[model samples]
Target chain A: MSITSLPETDRSVPLNRNRRSALIALAGLLVAEVVLGSIWKILPQNSAVSPNVFTALMFLMVPPILFFIYDAIWGIKSRNSKMASYPMMLIALGVFVLGTLWTVMFSFTNIKIIPLFTPADWVKGFVGLANYKRLFNTSRWMDCPGLTKAFQSGWEFKCAGALPNMVTYAVLSIAISVSLGFLLAVMMDQKIRAEGVFRTIFLYPFALSFVVTGHVWAWIMSPEYGLQHSIRALGWESFSFDWIANRDMVMYAIVIAGIWQGTGFVMALMLAGLRGIDDEIWKAAKVDGIPAWRTYIQIVLPMMKPVLVTTFVIVSSGAVRIYDLVVATTDGGPGISSDVPTRYIYQNFSANLGQSLSASTVMLVAMAVVLIPWIRVEFGKKSQA
Target chain B: MANTSTISAEPSGAKPKPFITWERAVVYTVLIVCALFFLLPLYIMIITSLKSISEIQGGNIFVPSSNPSLAAWEKAWNSACTGLYCEGIKVGFWNSIKITVPSTIVSIAVASISGYSLANWPFKFSEGFFTILLLGSFIPYVVMLYPIVIITRYLGIFSTLPAVVLVHTIFGLPIQTLLFRNYFASLPQELFKAARVDGASYWQIFFRVFVPMSVPIFTVSVILQVTGIWNDFLFGVIYAGPTNYPMTVQLNNIVNSAQGGKAYNVDMAATILTGLVPLTIYFISGKYFVRGIAAGAVKG
Candidate 1:
């Protein structure tokens, strides 16, 4: 027999063995899932199921399901007939599935039952969209006279509208940061001496976590011991920029701090896109007598679409997840005007168990809205490519 | 080459004009102005750190006074009260270092191996596996906090040094994996192919061929990871038990106590001290940063 063409018997034997193994693996996974499901139903609210049992079931179910889907898709496209690699793929899938299941299930259970592995009565208690309703519903908290008066009137009232403050902050911060970042990136990319140094200086803030940078900026922005007071000392009779205390502009103050930390991230992305441009393209443009400004606007920018999209996605995600910096600098105050989604979620989770699930659900929906389109576009491009 | 020649010829043929023009001068001036704008915060931070609380409160922020004292620095380092304890942020410096170092090492190691396997090894399900991992990166790290905390608590390690370190590593995995995988993918495939032909085992190829060639990217990883782990405050606060709080946590307490008066000078001094490690790393590794980005190691 030719080496390229295996003997009939040898091929048949290996093919049969492979088919048998895959079928066996599939059956084993089904059996494991069924056993786990039945156990979940019967086990006196989780008392019977071992932690290891859950982990093992997760491991088995995740890998085969993922591999089967992958193989099914692969089979449709290619003529190659090979079994999927299993181990790492399985673990990855298991971690995803089990982690998700654990999160969803654990959210319903309390501390006492969590350790004992007993299902809480709350587990079966279907709150439905009640959690989500409370999150977005203004009336729930508005019933409190203090909260109602606070929102209607000035900072005198302390009626804290949860969602409105965070949403406003995120929208303003994202708009300002992305626009300014793009502008700065373009300016720095001009053919000027010390451009590299400028880029470095702008990008340096990204290297420090918001916690560190926020503190520095907070001190500088402080009215009493910072720039505001300092400016007054310079023979200016009236210098008062106290946004840190002013509820109306407090969110903007937080945004200023955020921009200081975040603009560098956007600039770095834009710079990468700028640098990736071929030198020959610029030379060709010069030969064509195209002005540098026009060439950048018409030609270079179109080519940087992917980079711009990536920057937007990254920045938007960062905007939604704004937490540590806000907490560090504002602590969601000047009476909660600087509250953002992640901070809101964190506050709910830490303070009240009932509200935590609602906040998490809101967060999940927000992330989904942001991420789904980006992921779809990304996968779509990859598929087309 | 032709373009360069043409440029030289045109410049020579044209009347010899001065290299520096009014527009160029304006551009330079504007650029300098922007540079100063960026440097203002740093300028303020340094000056504030060197000044006393009296001067800081007295409001001379624009100019470094004729008498800039290191009293705040002393207070920040050893004597500023952050709760009942009068100890300064120096109390948490070693704990931060301990947490940061191990967390950085473990996260980078795991990410590199995972990235390498996904990039070069081409196991049957590598693509799908990697996709999941990539998706995991986009999940807000905060969302994972509750689940991770619960798991850690169940594991009997919550509110400890290890708890904080593990949390950092888990959170750091996504970006680190992305960085390394993209980097390794960009490397010449022939390197791996050659190793395979030479009967090199998986571990051998990774250790000998791949790891040696990874120095540039490793520096980038170190810079990014060190900055991330060093400056993490939430994980430090939530997971690191009180005795093991990081500098950021200490700084937060000093700046953000419920009823206590905010000490602006002490806070500034503490903030600078907390940022010192990563800032030093950036300055030292400045050369590697551009090269690493150019090498396509960091996507953003």
Candidate 2:
């Protein structure tokens, strides 16, 4: 046990008194493990290991191994009593090691034999930057002769890779959602009748899953039977809202639906921020003869920077991991025109493990680039206080 | 909590506005138009789900059908085909229940305990681990999904309902812990000191004292977890194999399947049915939902 630096109140309790006993307990545990191993070796005659037995053994081994290592390194020698934090630490360590650390390790490795499905197989080699080249090398598709027609039609023909699509999706969705959300928040801030109903109407979509929102919006965007069809039936025959089916316009259609679902959340956050502003600020602005729109744009929004940052983080995070909405809406239709990084990661996982890891690593790097500085300030403030 | 008073105060203060002012009329018009934009898809879904197939195919899609029928809803609930199962979403209804109920309970329980531990019991390495966990929450699940599959497969729980539940509890840990921790930290410290002075064990005090006081936060946590777990798709699709698929997964399969002829009405009904749980919670606990989001967003 490392020296537990307890607060003044806890200093009276001498935590190191049990070090000798804990050492003895550790030895006893080792003996028990040895005995159990002997028993297993003597009793097991089956040639194949049962998966259930293997899992049970893993569950049994983790705690003892954790405790044993901790005792040997810190618990037996340290003067701190942190037994209460042990469970939390154990779970955190398990999750970090097994869930995160392993995945990160797998990102750079090439597995010739997938071990999880076939346990006895073991083939692993480290391949540096090979997978990344495959991910970022959009020239494979860009060299296609078919895109020449696309280039001639005034469309900027570039790599039709998942990376470009994801970037476009993220940038467009975030810009539209945040700006539109701010507009709605400004509108809702007006002291008007049926505010509750209107607020509910606008924000209710936030509660529904992306699956549901994507489904409903897909139907509404259907050119044959949706808003366009309905509008055409009324007398306007040239109505064309075929964004869902159009390869060029499908990404925008996705953005519209995304904005629809996310704007409400952003608006709610901004509304809360707006409400938090003092009434005196509004009165002061009014007394100075400032226009309402000017007040919002110049005064209120700047004051709501914290709220804006929070909303940006939330919305951008959603954009980063967006998969279900795309699957439910476009499914990357019209020949992968609307593919996002997450969808690309998922698809590649089944076919090429290295490619999937490379794509997901790109996502992680993108998120970290945005999040790390904010996290530093957040935690830095906490540590300072 | 801070803005509740302000929010309620707005409508009453504006109740005496002039009935026919131009500005008021414009505000109302803008709000009504925005409301219509928001509500149009829902209206279409409800109406189309109630209309006959012929009406949906031939008539104006937005107009209400003269003869409303529950046949689509019935078909969605009782007999919609989900892959090989002819029994519709109800086939996965119980599976979802089995996955959601335990995942919610266990995730909330673990996170509450973790929150309580982190807030009340300070340790050398605890804060660092908490920070890592919080940051881990922001890391996209795709980064961890494959390794989690490998781990679960090694443990032999992959492609099972238990695997899905485990995944939820792991993924749900960060936000849930953040919620409970913040809520518990805001609580009066004297209650904890008093309980400690009374010789209450950690579990005892938690169960007998803090748990009771935590009912409201617990409600919020439950609401968050239940809706999240129930509405989950990616985890369910990946971890919970065909036999254990949740409602959302099954709904997607039913609606998005390219093999069969599309039944728009039944698809809408199934979509609505799958969404009903979360939507109900959203409507019923509207304020708490807002509170949950605010708390999560701020802390996150």
Candidate 3:
């Protein structure tokens, strides 16, 4: 954040006279309320002043608390407008800070269905690591039991939920989409015809939601009547694209659609990166007699390292949050074979709060891991510059 | 926009290359193939939606519909079943509009102001909150899912369009604020200082100075949010309840739910209907889509 780039601190001006007096008056009233036993009882018991906890809180806390902030740091004569953002900052803190911490803290308790935070509930419900344990070895959380060799027969595997599935989805989606996108970018860089047309075509799928993409691709890949049937009707009797029905192959189906939807955006990003590269680099490579592909591999890719990392991080983070696509296409189907972290957290939200919370906590961790380094590089460079 | 670079093994001068060269052939073949692959789904959806169910089930998907019709589209919009409620997906469309309009306006208004504040007025530890907001964009919804539910329920607006609206506004804050913040920060600081020196209020400066200068960023934020909130299925499914499901959620239900024998034509029609809004937005503002990403890319 450009903390060092703040404008020069101007001379402090005194507070506006009326506003200062009003603040002082409010502060004095708050002090009196604090000292007095009951300001509410001053009115007739049946009178207009109906003192409840909320109004009392508004009276006793909000004014004095806001006054402290103003008088302490910001209530200066010079800066009249900066406090306009205090409410926005307050909201950001509530959503990002309180919401996150609330989720993490409750993740430790046995909040099986709904959160109950009474003192007795805490005594009975605090179960450390219990939810985490279930996330791995339990029935719906067992790291891809489909491939564990126990469900080799006609057995439908219990989705030992989010574990390696999320990892697998993230890795595969990022790797496949990024490479495919880079290849497309290099191809587009050849000064091809219909460049804008091709760009728009590639990115149109990115515009659609995963639900649409999932269903269309589901129809396309389903063996019942999609590509498989169409190909067979066209005399390719042996062609089969039944990945959605197969357990281990379902992830690929999702990833293929994911790549289709995402690769276009990545290509767009990379194309932007490619365009930003100075033409002199290409001229130098030409003078050195390096092949074009070699120049790209050795020079261009390295130069686009920041863009590449950002794209990778982007794809990876999006992949980890794979809920709607999975829900739309297979719905964790072909027998719980393609369960992801997000779907797992959602499916268990009401059934098992602890499971959902702990799983969400893990997702929070996964998100942090993906973003921290990118943040450092992105904002760090700015502060320095 | 094309930057025609000189090749290593070629003449330095700009010369017209042979159109039928082997490399040109390879490149065109690859590009055309990719274009087709990208175009395949849209093509399939259009034809499938137009074809009769009998044709879709029995005939090849690649072949154009010999007897194309809008019956499926009519059914999808007029009478498609989503559970026992067979009033069609149009309900979702209207609900989507209802949700999207308010969310887009409120989110943009709040975020632009916050962005203006963060960029112009660097109060103490404001950077700290901005960092949290930027980083908060990366937080998965699963973490905030239950907490938002509790909050909405507490506010007595659970399972309603308002809840979804609030959620979109909250989630849209990080990126939208970032877009405006970075845009405002890039502007000549002299303008801001000059306004302050002239005794302009925050609203005065935002409306006159900042808003006048920020049309493109505003457009980008609008495009991003309209498409985003339109395409959203998760919040619509969870927070909006059954009565307020967005088009995406209803489309999924219409396609995946098996009541009678599956109606591929109607499903495809509903799919196209759901996708039409975003697809149109993507085409109209495709350049801004990419530009917005580049502006908000991690180098920020």
Candidate 4:
């Protein structure tokens, strides 16, 4: 509603009305939960629990209640709150909390904890790092048909040491995505003709989902019907580039696709930084007869450090979460040569149900390793500044 | 260094030609080569999409001699098989639009309110709340995905249109909030104070005073959120359900399925088709790009 022109005397009316509506919403939510729970209690145990309908209902309702409680408490303190005092905040918060609780409860108790909570019996079977250990410790990974076929007959398969192919994929892809992004950004910053067109071309890949870009790249890199084969037809007799198949080279192939998708983001960020540069410096540099290369190296590079850092952080974040591209491109194959952490997590959660928790643990650890430093730097910068 | 000083000292004598002259032709040359390298994949994608599958397998990818055909396009649009279904990415087009539109609107709306509150209202907890929101942005969304999936399922909307939209909104919140908040914070405080003095209430001030002035930032927000939600595959797949799969998911199935030989022509055609919406948005909104950034939402 209109919040700007509320007379001082009338402000309390809307505030009170909002609070009343919030309470009603919260109450309605509670009643719905109780009704669903009662219905759940009445149904035959087998039928009732099958869909986890009761748990789902509770999960849906609890978020608004929690949010209502939060808003009520905050409302009392503020006393003149408007829409903020309503149940929307409570709903969002409630859903988040209830969802977490339901998921956790379902994992431990085999019973349908809630309709919304999926049965996690398979995941609960393996606690802690057991699943992780099994994944990393297996020699059978090399024996997978996808892996063997991708590597061809002559190649020797290396046993995974600690992390699986997926985790390695995430790490390597992220590194390549961010670094190449930065390099592209720096290159784009140079004063050149057709810069706009070049920038668009670079960014065009970002517009396409990983599914589209990944598939296109997969085809281009395919051995039989791809660019490699086309090149071979040009009478380059000894030319055989089977990157998508070679286990050692598979990650690089994925990285090449990633770089193609990512460099545009970096270019945009860097160009933003470049345009923000104070013109006075350039004029001063020219006046001082500073060589163009030296100006960029010594002056401009240092100045764009913040933009560079931001780009690196953003790109790296996307990199570590690599999943869709790998799935779309290689399906974690030419055997698991191109598996990334997210893909591994997805596989466990969806297909290898028994290993879901273990996969999550790996994902959590990988994310923490990358994120902790970033969070620290972010906070450090704010506090220091 | 001596020559540099001489040029500066002789500002009136003869403007020492532009700094980026033909002597710096190497820079242009390098950029041109880089540009070509960058454009090569796109060229391959377009040409491959236009060629027949037989022609695609026949010879040189760079060579356009293979008979150009719309067969792949027709397949991509109308009849590519994704599992039991033979309908193409078109099946997911409306669903993607449904998920994207609401998510974008609600996200931009909530972010505006939150951002406005942070910028204008002197609430005691605003900064703390904003800080937490900022921190939330850093959490790898993948970590949150499982948790969110569980949460959404618990909410009984896990594989529904609303579930996907909600997910998008939640994920989009931090950046959207940050963008608008920063943008609002940069605006002159006097205007806000003046509006309040003129008896403008919070909502009025937001709509009449703040929003109208936020066109540039809004354009930026639209571009960012639209691209993100429209191109998203994972969330769309998980939350949007099979009934509401986005084009990207369909595109994935068509291009990535492990069953048979790779279909290069159809795959490229589908990729380009699915990317069209965002590509169009980018092209149409080209003029807004610089203005969006210039409004200083990203300024450090």
The lDDT values for all models are: 0.66, 0.75, 0.80, 0.66
Q: Which should have the higher TM-score, number 1 or number 2?
A: 2
* Candidate 3: chain B TM-score against the reference chain B: 0.93
CAPRI verdict (incorrect, acceptable, medium, high) for model 2: acceptable
- Give the worst 10-residue stretch by lDDT in candidate 4 chain A: A1-10
Listed models, DockQ each:
0.27, 0.46, 0.43, 0.27
Best by lDDT: 3
Q: Estimate, for each residue in B128-241, the C-alpha lDDT of model 4 and write its tens digit.
A: 556655545555555556667766665567788888888888878767776776667768877877786787767788889889999978988898888889889889878889
Please give the lDDT score for candidate 4: 0.66
Give the Cα-based TM-score of candidate 3 against the true structure.
Answer: 0.88
Could you tell me every candidate's TM-score relative to the true structure? 0.80, 0.87, 0.88, 0.79
Q: Model 1 chain A, poorest ten-residue lDDT window?
A: A1-10
Using alpha carbons, what is the TM-score of model 4?
Answer: 0.79
Please, what are the lDDT tens digits per residue for candidate 4 over residues A111-195?
Answer: 2222323345535532544444565545433224345556676666454522455445556666665556555655655544456
Off by over 4 Å in 1: A1-97, A100-123, A138-162, A287-289, B1-17, B258-260, B290-300
Q: State candidate 1's DockQ.
A: 0.27
Query: Residue B267 deviation, candidate 4, in Å?
Result: 2.1
Better of 2 and 4 by lDDT: 2
Q: What is residue A169's positional error in candidate 3, in angstroms?
A: 1.8
Give the candidate order by descending TM-score: 3, 2, 1, 4
Top candidate when judged by TM-score against the true structure: 3
